[model samples]
Target: MKRPVPRIDLFDVRPDDERAFVFAQDLRIIEARLFSSAEPQTSTTLRPHLSAKADVGALMEALQRDYAPRGVNLLRVAGGWMLCTAPDLAPVLNEQAPEQRKLSRAAVEVLAIIAYHQPVTRAEIEDIRGVSTSKGTLDVLLETGWIRLRGRRRTPGRPVTYGTTPAFLVQFGLDSVQDLPGLDELKGAGLLDGRIPAGFSIPLPSDDPQLHEDEEPVEPEPLDFTLSPLPTADEDEN
Candidate 1:
């Protein structure tokens, strides 16, 4: 008879060092899942595949550390984590994507006001901008899916309030509306005048999806807008 083959139970005879190796293997699996996913993965969605003792936070931290210096980085977006190219690579990647149309100056101003002071009404936006807002301006923003009607204010006339959408956050690369640059940051970027106004401050923006106590749900309304004819060459000349 052949010499009895030495029987070794890998699981039963595993060394203490193997525990760390197994933990690392688990991290690799998590990393692969996140890397391969098209959308961000939440901890709850990723936990089932992990052992009971596996710490999701620690695994995510490890993956973040590993990719920190790489072109791709793990980012938290909309309450979940996803892999994204580093900010430094934006210019290069932007060239690969289609040319994005820029918002008009008026639209930009209206959007900024709405973002910073949301649950704001058309009248409020006009007041802040010191001019009357054309219905077409709001229509353009609504069509773009950036701003949305929040609810009607509980005051007189009960005008519809507007707020920024998640699409706005994503378009601006913001994780939340709270991440908007503060007044000081705006001044540093030369976006705000450095005038010395005592107690001047920026309002904190909230992304709360629910209607506030002062707001009422919007009621379905028939569209009342009509398009005007484009200006002809003769009209343009005049």
Candidate 2:
């Protein structure tokens, strides 16, 4: 004899019609988890409490709405969500503790070069700067979480190319690399001389985060090679 088929009620309502109540309870659970944790939580980390059909995006939206006017606001940071102080409160908070540890001139220059001419190799940076760049300068930018190794050039020796990170866009208040100051803006800001050669221009920067036609995918930096000094301008000439 054939076994009877089990019936599954996809829309079955629970007692007291408590589905909405259950969602609200789940929202509270998520809120408590976020509040108690010191670090930002990703959806994957918070999914255990939610049913398979639960909409994590909707829950996050609701939480964001609820916290919009509060002292703490939900913010997307470094590709994850975190609760952060309101922008209006920043000035008051900053007054209590001033910023220290400014970037050195070399570090600043290196950062600027990487931001503007990204996916650039060390040799390209040196060529633009008219001086040799120190590995320490690159290290400082890396430590700041502003720039990252993108890939290696397809040319000889496959030197690693560098590019600005998403953190760089967040820190600089830029929506995209294309929003970087152009020649006209630079001239207006007095960063560049008003009098310049005809057809002088800044190349439009790309933030595509993909290896270009001339680039090979990045390989892991060798453990022993990372500490070694990068080639200087003189070394490049030789």
* Model 1, global lDDT: 0.83
Model 2 segments more than 4 A misplaced = 1-17, 36-45, 95-99, 128-131, 165-210, 217-238
- Candidate 2 lDDT (Cα, whole model)? 0.78
| Residue 156 lDDT, candidate 2, scale 0-100 | 93
TM-score of 2: 0.63
- Candidate 1 residue 166 Cα shift, in angstroms, is 2.2
Computed on alpha carbons, the lDDT of every model, listed in order, comes to: 0.83, 0.78
Kindly report which residue pairs in candidate 1 clash with one another.
Answer: none
Residue-by-residue lDDT tens digits, candidate 1, 61-124: 7777778999999887756688889999988888799877878899999999999999899999
The deviation in Å at residue 88 for candidate 1 is 1.4
Candidate 2, 1-238: lDDT as tens digits: 6332222232453556566555666677777888887556678888897766666777777778778999998776544566778888987788787676899988898888888888899999999889999998899889998899899999999999999987786675455688789888898899998678788767888867878999989876677645768999999999
Off by over 4 Å in 1: 1-33, 36-39, 48-50, 196-198, 222-238
Please report, as a residue range, the 10-residue window in candidate 2 with the lowest summed lDDT.
2-11
